[model samples]
Target: MWSGPRNLSTAMMYAFAARGDCAVWDEPFYAAYLKATGIDHPMRQEIMTAHDADPDRVAAACRGPAPDGQAIFYQKHMTLHMIDGFDRGFMRDCTNVFLIRHPARVVASYAQKREGPTLADIGFVQQAELFDQVADWLGRAPAVIDSHDIRTNPRDALESLCHTLQLPFTERMLSWPAGPKPFDGIWASHWYNAVHASTGFGAPEGPLPELAADYRRLVDQAMPYYERILRESGRNPNSPA
Candidate 1:
């Protein structure tokens, strides 16, 4: 799974982890991204110390067999973390799914966590680039799921997604026990409080939260990229059940 921050990604990871056969990995490239870029993210030092900071090693692991001999390996990836120096070849070996939310929603939610996000910080451009890369490699568009659709009707949305991925839909993907899992990255303390407090997807989001002028401009910069991918993402939360 590939997504930006605050995009229901953690919940989706928990849902997949709830399935006994799947082994989930949370943001494997994050430490490497931070190390390479030297960006001052919250928990930057601790995250680099706790997680492997070598992109090559991380990429190798991603291409390696599922840990502990599990039948499926579900890796939750952040599009922003795939910085320029990182090798993306490993993605060729796995199924790629893009998880997206409206730019207004992403910008609003992200601002509440970390102040003053830019277009790169929120990952709209990187996501579209990655999507196109995968699509080019496969000769077609890859699977995509909107966060709104997942929140609005998780069952129908995930069922459709599972079908696209050729996996059976299980009620296990709908919810999980509240709190952190062993797989969460060390940065979870700074980023995952809301997801940790939940057992499932939250109530469908209310109207897109109002944004201040500068943030609204950021959303505008991100909208074209969001809409480009949304055109390929078949699910619509507002569509009739």
Candidate 2:
């Protein structure tokens, strides 16, 4: 799945990891992204030291064999990680799915952990770019799931996803052990407290963030990109923004 930071991507990762037939990889290209962009995310030095820093090598590994020879490889990816010059051709080798949340929610959640997140830092522009590129390449829009739909009605949303991806809908995907797994990236320590404490998708949190003036402006800049994606994918029309 192609997702942005703090977009329930980790929860979905846990869901898929629950399936017996599927194996999961959490943000395999993260180290490379941090290395290439020098973006000052939390745990930067720890992340770099723990994984491969070469983007080309990471791409090759992604296109290589599935770990443990599993039947399905569920790669949970961050769209922002695909920096300039990163080879996205390997995307064609697997089914590409996009998972999105409202810009307001994402920006709010992200800001709690880090200050001054730009549009790129939140992954809105990059997600839209990848969505369009994949749509053009496949000559059809790939699956797009709004995070709200998954949180509010997981079975319905996941059933829709499984149909789109041609995968089975397992009850197993609805729940998982409530703790860190072997597949989580090292950076999970800094970012996955909520997910690590959950067995299933939780209730939607209080309200979307009422952003400060600066963050509200960032949200304004991102809304058009977010709406364009919804228009293009034409899914979850009723999902709350």
Candidate 3:
């Protein structure tokens, strides 16, 4: 899925993994881009700290045949990763999904997870630019989900997602059975507390801690584009980022 920073894009990746037939890869492009650009971001560092190391290379490791030859493959991607001078190799040869959350919650989650940029830290125009790049790939008319809705109703959200992808909605999609799965994103543990804390989708989450004012301001600035995407996503008003 194409997304911007601080969205629960990774958790959504986990949710897809929970469905049990999807071979998930979290930010595969990240390690590749890091190798290519020698650049770093805070979350990127958290992502690469795993014992195996080198997610970019690891992404390459999964490049061959599909696991089980029947499972869906879900990759978590970021908007900024598509920037000029960044690797674009990941964009080819794939059906696309675009996931979004209110930038406010994204900013709040950013604050909670790392010491770096707030969603507000980057400003709306810049965020919009990133979204535009993401939108280009996802299509002006692609599947989009609001983080709030995802927090409120995962089953319906995922059911609709299944329809959009033209895949069946299995009970497995709604929940994870006990087993080991690798969800090796840079920020998984740091950002996944809320997701792990849930038994089922609950109410639409309110703004995250300490981000109310910024969330409101961001909402005002971002509402127009977001709402427009909502009308075109052909998705439940609520979907996970």
Candidate 4:
């Protein structure tokens, strides 16, 4: 699955990891992103040190045999990580699911932790770019699940996504143990505290943060792409694939 920061991506990762047949990978391309861009992210040194920094090597591993011979390898990816020169051919072997949230929410949530995040930082443009490329490659749009739908009606939304990927929806996906797992990225401590504290989806959030000037500009910059993907995505949570 591809998503931006502060989306329900970690939650979705835990959801899939709950399934016995699935082996989950969290933000496999993150180290590569940091290495390529040389951006100063929280835990940047630790992340780059802990994970492979070569995108080609990471891509090779992603397309390699599923770990421990698991039936499904659920790769949780950030669209922004596919920086220039990153190979996308590995995606053809996998079912790509795009998970999106409103750009306003993403901007607000991200700003709380990191300051001055541009549109690129939140990944709305990169996501739409990849979505279009994948759609053209597949001759149709891939499955997409909005964070709102998942938060409000997870079972229906996940069932539809599973149908798209030709997998079964398990009750186990609805919940999991409240803590980190072996599969989590080393940066999880900085990024995953909320998810680590949850057994399942948390209660619906109340009013979102009031965007600062920079964040509001980012939202404006990203809205077009977000709206485009939202229209192309599978909007009905209960629809068959």
Candidate 5:
């Protein structure tokens, strides 16, 4: 899934990985790519301090046993991480799932995260820029699901996603046992909150107390672009943003 920082990306990763037979690759190639590309990202130090994803090993990991026609494989990725010197085909060839939240909520969550900088401080504009870039690359046809909507009606939402990915619908996909699963991104505990730890769908969370108003404002701005993209692609959400 393509996601931005502080969104429910990891939790969604957990949700996907929760399936007993899925092979989850949590930010599998990210750190090595970050080091390879040499971007001055705020999370650079943390990434360096965190897991060291060896690039060569990353290639092997990304090329894990071809689908095997059994479990759904999950790969946690960020749209922002596509920098120079990385294999762009990594995301394009995959079943491309996009997870996004209101920029306002992202900012607030960044603050609570105690990460180097708040989304307001750096991430809001930067992350959105990367988001636009990924969208452009994916064209208007990219598969996207609002994190809010997923949390609100996960069964319906993820069912649609499975349809998009051409995977069979299974009730087990609705909810699975909670708790940490394999390849939980290093960021799992810090940002996932209690909601991420659970298996069931939830009342769309993320708009924080401090950013509720701003969240609505940004959501309004994003709606037109989102609507246009969905319209052009002819894939409307059961509940449009």
Candidate 6:
């Protein structure tokens, strides 16, 4: 799954990991991204030390067979982590799905964890770019699903998604044991507290949170990219659905 942070991504990861046939990889490019960019992030040293910091090696692993010989490999990816100069050729080997949330919610939720994020930090632009890249390569638009739709009606949303991927839908995707899984990245401690405490998707979101003007402006910049993908998902962003 290609998604931005704080976008119900962890919950979705847990849902897939719950399925017996799938082996999950969490943000495999994260350490490589950090190592290449030298960006400051929580647990920077530990993350680099603990995870593979080589993007080429990580890409090779991504293209390799599913770990433990599982039938499916579900990778939880951060779109922002695929910075410029990183080759995305590996994506063509996998079925790409873009998971998006409204920028307002993304900015609000992300600010709670890490402050003053730029447009690049939340990944709306890069997501649209990757979506377009995949679509171009496939000669059709790839699957797109809004995180709002997933949280509001997970079964229907995921059922539709699995159908698109030609995978079987299972009740096992609905809930998971509370707490982190063995596959979680070491940075989970800094970012996954709420998801760790939950057994499943949270209640449908309340009204979009109010944001400070600066953050609100950031949302304004991100909305076009979000809405563009939402349209490909076959949902009009303006619709109540």
Give the winner by TM-score: 6
Reference-based TM-score of each model: 0.96, 0.96, 0.70, 0.94, 0.70, 0.97
In model 2, residue pairs whose N, Cα or C atoms come closer than 3 Å (at least 3 residues apart or on different chains), thus clashing, are none
Deviation of model 6 at 151, angstroms: 1.1
lDDT string for model 3 (1-241, tens) is 7777656665677677777677776666565555545665556655445423454444454453556663677777665544455434444455666676765566666666654453334333433455455567656655566666666777777887789789888766555533333565645565566666654455677544455664566556665555555655554434443
Provide the clashing-pair count of each candidate structure: 0, 0, 3, 0, 0, 0
Clashing pairs in 5: none
Candidate 1 residue-wise lDDT, 1-241, digit = tens: 9998888889999999998889999999999999999998999999999999999999999996999899889999999999988999999999999998888888888888899998999998999999999999998889988888888989999999889988898998888888888999898898999999998888787778888999999988988888888776544434421
Task: Locate the minimum summed-lDDT window of 10 residues in model 1.
Answer: 232-241
Model 5 off-target regions past 4 Å?
33-50, 56-60, 66-70, 115-140, 193-196, 206-209, 212-241
lDDT of 6 by residue, 45-79 (tens): 99999999989889888986999999999999999
Per-residue alpha-carbon lDDT of candidate 4 for residues 47-87, written as tens digits (9 for 90 to 100): 99999998998898899588989999989999999998999
Candidate numbers sorted by lDDT from highest down: 6, 1, 2, 4, 5, 3
Answer with 1 or 5, whichever has the higher lDDT: 1
Model 4 scores worst on lDDT over the 10 consecutive residues at 232-241
With candidate 4 superimposed using the best TM-score fit, by how many Å does residue 164's alpha carbon deviate from the native? 1.6
Clashing pairs in 6: none
lDDT of model 5, residue 192 = 58
lDDT of 2 by residue, 110-209 (tens): 9888889988898889998999999999898888889888888899999989988888899999999988898899988888998899999987566677
